[model samples]
Structure formats: C-alpha cells, structure tokens
Target: MLFLNELLDELQSGDYFLLYVLVSAIAISVIFAIIGTIVSMNKLVFIAGGVSHASFGGVGIGFLLAYHFGWKNFIDYSGPIYSALVFAMFVATVIYFLTRHQKRYSDAVIGAMWALGMAIGVICIERVPGLKISIESYLFGSILYVNSLDTIILCILAVILSILFFVFYKTILSMSYDEEFASIRGIPVNLLYFITLQFISIAIVLSINFIGIILVIALLTMAPYIMERFLHSMKQIVMGAIVLNLIFCICGLAIAYQFDMNTGPCIVVFAAIIFFISISAQKVLKKA
Candidate 1:
C-alpha cells in the first residue's frame, strides 16, 4: 500500500520525463524482442555485434559533421543515432555481399570491420577541437536522458518492425530455415536477406541509445536465446522474449531509482542474473 501510494504520487505529479522513460522502455522492449527472435533464428549474432560497433564510426563522423556545420546542439537532438543508423545500414550491406558465399572468412572479415570502425571513431573524436564527449555514455548508454524526439522515433520503429514481421512471417521463417528452399518457393531470398540486414542495422542503432553498442548484442541475443531453450514456436519465443525484456527493464528501472544506480547497467545486470537462472533451470530439467 505504501509503495502504491508513492507510485500514485509520482504519477499524479505528471512527470513528462518519467512518461518519456516509460514509452522508451516499452517501445524498445517490443523492438528488441522482435529483432532478437529474428537474429537468433538466423544465427546472425556476430553480424549484429559487428553492426553495433561499426555504427560507432558513424557517431564520430556525425559529431565531426555536426560541429563543422555549426550545429553544436545537434548531438543532443539524437544526431548520433541517425548517423550511426546510416553507417550501420551500409556496414550491413557490405557484410552481406562479402560474406554471402564465404562462410569460412565471414568472422575474420567481420572482426576487421568491427575494429576498423571503432578505430575510425577514435580518430574522429580526437580531431574535434575543445569537444567534451563522454565515451561512457556512447559506450554504455543513457536511457534516462532520452528526450521526446527519441521516444517518438522508438514508437515508430516498434510499429514498423512489428508490421513487417507480422505480414512476412512465413517468408522470414522460410529464409531463416533454408535459403535455397525459400528461393525455390519464389520468396525473394536475396531481397529478404538484404532487408533483414537493414532491419537488424536499424535495431542495433536505435538500441544503442538504451543498451549501448557494447551490450546491445546481449539485448538482441539473450532474451531470444533464453526463450528458445524452452519455447517451441517462433511466435511463442517472440512473445516470451518481450515479456522477459519488459520484466528486466521495469525491475531494473525500479532498482535504479531506489539505489540511484546507472539505469543501463542495472537493466543489463538484472537480465544477466535471470539468464543464468534460466540456464541452471534448464540443466536441472535435463538431468531429470
């Protein structure tokens, strides 16, 4: 009852920042669940990781361009996310073309891209004159600081990703299981693969705001993988991932509020704990 009353007080106060945080959390959960399911099905965890880091190069470039164009306030306007989105898309495309037929070398190429992208970012940041950028925010994330624009963008992305997956569910499934069979069925395999990469790129870039690039892959992989251990169907796995992610985000946020801890790491740490618990449960069940 006391907790409910304090919650009611916070609600009655009409905190717009709190509202934004809620919306961002909800939208991001939806996005992460869908993308996590897809990426896990496709087994493209490395691709997601590569794109997440490669997008950092875009952040550095965006910062440089924004400053040169006399838009010092651009960074606060979510310029880095957009810039990274473009770069991520490009990186995704490059990875697809180069690795489509070279399964043996894909990992090596991806590693190179990942390292080069961050190196480029480091150089760009160094070239900026009198610029005070906190790499930690970009490295870790600052979900509490998301503004109205970001919340709106996340809502739109959540809708877009949901609609795309719903309408093309079988097509995505077919491609994920057997690309040659999907192509034989006239499912536009190449186009779908390209499209998947783009969506993955978008998911990675947008999530950088909440989970940060370093831990973003965990958000894309952990929930889906956990669900796959117990769930059978794709839809079930997606729904389960969404619920689990929501639980993590909400509980993590509450703990962060109560303890004045960093929201991003709190959420991540909570998810990690749950992940290990799930693993232990699975092992026990298997032994039985």
Candidate 2:
C-alpha cells in the first residue's frame, strides 16, 4: 500500500513520462487480451510466436533499407513497426495456406519459419555496412522508452481492434469454434481466418516495442489461456483475460519501477509465475 502510494505520488508529481509508460503498458495489455483470445480460440497460439519472430526479419529489412538508401521516413522508430507488419502479414498468410493441407506438419513448418526469420534478421543485420542498430530493444523490449507518438499509435490500434471485435463478434466466434461449420454456413471462413492472422500479425508487431518480440507471445497467449481454464464463453474469456492482463501489466510495471529493472522480462516473469500457479491449482481441483 505504501509502495502504491509512493508510485502514485511520483507519477502525479510531474513524472508524466512514467504516466505515459503506464498507459502504454495498459493499452498493450488490452490489445494482447483481445488478440490472445482470438489466437487461442482459433488454436493458433504457436502461429502467434511464429509471426512474432518473422517480424524480426522485417525489422532487419527495414533497418537495412533505411540505412542503405537513405529513406528518411523509414528511418524513424515506427519504421520497423511498419516493416514488421508487412513481413508478419506475409508470413501469416503463407503459414495459413501451407498448413491448410498438412495439418500434421504445421508445427514443423512453423518452427522452420521461426528459425528462418531469426536467421534472416541476424544475417541482414550483419551484412549491412555502416548500419548501426541495437537489437536489444527488439529482443528484450524497452517500454519505458516509449514516446508520446508511440502511445498515440498504440491507443489508435487498441480502438481499431475493439471496433473490429465488436463488428465481427459473431463471424469470429463461429470461425473459431468450428471452421467446417462456419464454412458450411458461408461465413467466409478463409477470409475471416486470413483477416484474423493479419490482426494477430499487427498485434505482434505493435507490441514488439512494449514487450519485446521474445516475450510478446507469452503476453498474447498466456492471459487468455489462464482465463480459458475458468471461463467457457468467448465473451467471458475475453473480458476475464483483459482484466487479468491489466492486473499483470500494472503489477509488473510497478515492480519494475520500484526495483529499477527491465519491464519486459519482469512482466513475463510475473505472468509465468501466475500461469504455473493457475495450472497447479487446476490440478489440485481435478484431484479433488
């Protein structure tokens, strides 16, 4: 309680930057909650990780192109975000089509793509001459360094995702539960699935700065998974996951601040602990 008071006091006493960081953290959590629900419901949680790693290739490409050709517009911080979006969408689309037939080999394919993406990123970064870039932020995240523009972009994305969710709730629900039934009913299963992948890609790309690429998948899938253990309805799962994500993000942020630690790992570590606890509790209940 005292720590909470002190943190609130610090934020209120002109540390508006920290306030922005907190807002960004919360917004990313909400975005993750929404995307996480969709990913888990669709059973594409692994794909989320694949898409995220694939985005690193895009970041490398963006950096290379920006430095070599002097694309000033693409040299900004958001440049990698856009680049990753394109790469992620492409990867997601490819994976979607490839896995359509060989369901058994989907994991193998995704694992290959994951490794390929990171390898490409490393090669690109190494091959580029006179290009100075730190992969630390992309790998481990540095949410505290987020600026106002980043916050605004995150806010816009959150709103867009919410609106999309509201508009396509039924379509998404149907597609998630049973693709065959959705296709039978002419729900445009392929189209909707593709769109969902794109959204997941976008979510992963945007969240890279907030949670880093390596840990972003955990944020995207863990909360929803946790909620699923308790909730059966999609709506309930979404709402529950959002609340859980919010609590986790805030707690992680507060702890990071107090300890002067890295926020991304802290958040992931906290979430991992909660996930283990939830699983243990479930086991105990099942035994009873």
TM-score of each: 0.94, 0.91
RMSD of 2: 2.3
Q: Summarize candidate 1's per-residue lDDT along 53-81 as a digit string, tens digits.
A: 98899888888888788887775537777
Worst 10 residues of 1 by lDDT: 1-10
**In candidate 1, which residue pairs get closer than 3 Å at backbone N, Cα or C atoms, i.e. clash?**
none
Model 1 global lDDT (CA atoms, 0 to 1): 0.83
* Tens-digit lDDT string for candidate 2 (98-133): 986788999988988888888888877776776544
Cα RMSDs, all models = 2.0, 2.3
